[model samples]
Target: MALKTSCPCCGKPFSAPEDYAGKKVNCPKCDHRFVLKTREQALQEAADLEAEKLRQLEDRRRIELIEREERKHRDRRASMPYYEKFQTGTRPVRNYDPRSGPGFLNLRYLADLLLIGAYAVLMLALAGLGLTVYLKFAGVISSIVILSIVLIGWILVGGVLFLLLKYLAELALLMASLGDQQNDVVRLLLDLRDNTDVDSPEQG
Candidate 1:
């Protein structure tokens, strides 16, 4: 009597000898080569093999994902700024508040104003006191002395006051720039903290 078998390649029913174990057969539908087995046994073996292959593929995919995440973490850590490592203290180095108060009333500004007033007074005094001495000399000499004294006094007072004002102006500008930089740093740090908190589960 002919025993029932299935072609592994085609899933087609066929009649074959029961003793034909591990015997190669041809699929009539697709002309593929496969071993002959009972229909139920062939189907069960095919399903089991497919399941094993699927499990291996899933495991490989999971491993790849984990490796990718680790690489990203390593790259992010490596790309951090150089200063972040040496910064041991948690407190910020500088703080800025633009709207807190007026900057014009500071000690440096007051000093500059005082220096300007003093320079003006000295210029007036030099012009008044030296006029009589300058008038006593002869034509060219008196003229030269008067001109020289006036020029010298002007230079002394104007130059000194100009330098002082320039220095104070520079100082004020530097303070403003530093304040802006400090404010920017503080904002960036706050943003970084907010992002970190959102991504991490643990809170401080």
Candidate 2:
């Protein structure tokens, strides 16, 4: 017996042997080979293709959402001021540039310089006090008293010197970075007085 069927590839109606109902065949009109699927198998394949298309669409949506979030983060970062991004002690000191325009003075740098100057004055005062103590008590006081005074004076001087050295180290870093830091106290104070008017954006 012959079976009536249509070629899916060429859309040509043709007759096939009944035994060819669920087999592969070639379309004579288009010379295209295809599987002659049963009605149930064809339905299952169409359902599977639709499911795959849905999965692909969902994946694309998720990727688009991720890209949108990334763009928002970039915009937020771009909107922030240059100064807000820098943290103290995180930046490495750079070489001083003489030609670079005098930058604004940093309040923190001025405070460090003040502390160093105070320590220097304290050292001078301590020296004078030690000299007075030695001259006044050298002849009448016991040897132990003289030794104790010397020891105390040396300890105080050592402490002040240690602090002074630390301040000097900090000052060196400030000077090295003065291309960004201010050139002098006057320029620094002037900038401080007019900070709001200064355009301090990061320029390329």
Candidate 3:
């Protein structure tokens, strides 16, 4: 599209391009020269162009700030070992050195190792008991009845011991996890806060 204009002196009509708004032009009929746009229009367009430049600069700064913040959050999450557990579907094993940690924690770790060793010995004894039952009842009772007695005894004893061990460990870990969740919520709130004050470009 072009700017519609007419020669003021001869009243002859002609059209100039939008880009030629502020430029001087000659009339085709009488060779009269004039500017396509008025002085007020040219100054207003210049002011508008300056305002557009400021707006674009403000927009680019806002985008860069947002991108930088996103990168920081992403890097922080990636560096956390606890966050990786879900993706890996397993926790990384760390050696529990008694000398490296608190005294009570070290004692608890040692106790856990001793309990595991005792459980292993108990399982072996249970196996021996099953063997003894088979030997004692091999000829005296039916095979199904002997097997039933052995299974019921093992189930009752093993289930109680397993429940005691598992419940304590799970409860302790659950309390620790709850504490971690509380800290995470506070950290997240701090991260999500908008501390940077950015004023938008003023158009005049």
Per-model TM-score versus the true fold = 0.31, 0.36, 0.34
**Best of the candidates, lDDT:** 3
TM-score computed on alpha carbons, candidate 2: 0.36
lDDT of 1 by residue, 8-53 (tens): 6667877776566467767667778777665567678879999999
Q: After superposition, how far is residue 124 of candidate 3 from its true place, in Å?
A: 3.6
lDDT of 1: 0.62
Q: Please estimate how well model 2 matches the true structure, expressed as its whole-model Cα lDDT.
A: 0.64
C-alpha-based local distance difference test score of model 3? 0.64
Please list all clashing residue pairs in model 2, or write none if there are none.
none
At residue 49, candidate 2 shows an lDDT of: 88
Q: Encode model 2's per-residue lDDT on 49-85: one tens digit a residue.
A: 8999999999999999999999998888676443222
Judge candidate 1 at residue 109 and give its lDDT. Answer: 65
Top TM-score model: 2
Q: In model 1, where is the ten-residue run with the lowest total lDDT?
A: 88-97
Rank list by lDDT: 3, 2, 1
